[model samples]
Target: MTTDGCVFCRIAARELDASVVLESATVLAFLDADPVTPGHVLVVPRAHLPTLADLDEDIAAEMFLVARSVAGALRQSSLRCDGVNLFYADG
Candidate 1:
């Protein structure tokens, strides 16, 4: 399910544009349009959930897995960062 006017839902639905880095059945990882760092990304469930409490455990796990993979790629890429940080935000 999805919420009307949800930016993430729009991104997941391909109604909006995002520099997607990773995508799976349950999650989508994309570059942050307004980023703290060059490689900053947002990992989100494809479903629209208002908060973390509303997220399914399986989907949450997948989100992290996707985040991990993205982080590793960022570290190994031309960005040449020694490490990566993952942040979770709910809106």
Candidate 2:
């Protein structure tokens, strides 16, 4: 369910640019262009459904699988932190 002009779709086709981290037959992972933390990443499906209800169970499972892998890597990564701190600058 990719949009006619979506950034993720372009990233998938290589028509646009992105710093991909992980990729599988059905998924791709890239660093967050606007990150909330030092090493924030984005794990998205090759398709652009926009919502989980629009995706099949298999795709959802794979998405979570990628997230799990990312989490594992983060745990052992040099970017790992002992505690997570949250703050907001919005007013």
Candidate 3:
């Protein structure tokens, strides 16, 4: 979907409240309010791109870089983390 009025966009724009963990010029990472597990986060690009294929290379790279950093932080946290799983959902 387009970024206009999108919930993610709102979060990125700071119009919505989110427990943000990491943010860069191109990406935003925040805690999922209804997390399936503790520390669960949703990392997204500031620009609205419906699917991975739609994302420009640079933005996609930045998004994954942020995701990696988040996972690393999670692994280093006090939580009993066994491993990290990454999932991408587009709808």
Q: Return the top candidate by lDDT.
A: 3
C-alpha lDDT of residue 77 in model 1: 90
Q: Which stretches of candidate 1 lie over 4 Å from their true place?
A: none
Q: List the lowest-lDDT window of 10 residues for candidate 2.
A: 82-91
lDDT of 2 by residue, 1-91 (tens): 4378877788888888888878888888787788888667777778776665776898778877876777677778898556433221121
Over 26-83, each residue of candidate 3 has an lDDT whose tens digit, in order, gives 9999999899999899999887776788889999889899999999999999988898
TM-score of each: 0.92, 0.80, 0.92
lDDT at residue 22 of model 2 (Cα atoms): 83
Error of 3 at 86 (Å): 0.4
Candidate 1's displacement at residue 91, Å, is 3.2
On the 0 to 100 scale, the lDDT of residue 52 in model 1 is 88
Residue 91 displacement in candidate 2 (angstroms)? 25
lDDT of 3: 0.90
* Shift of residue 2 alpha carbon in model 2, Å: 5.4
Residue 62's lDDT within candidate 3 is 95
Between prediction 2 and prediction 3, the one with superior lDDT is: 3
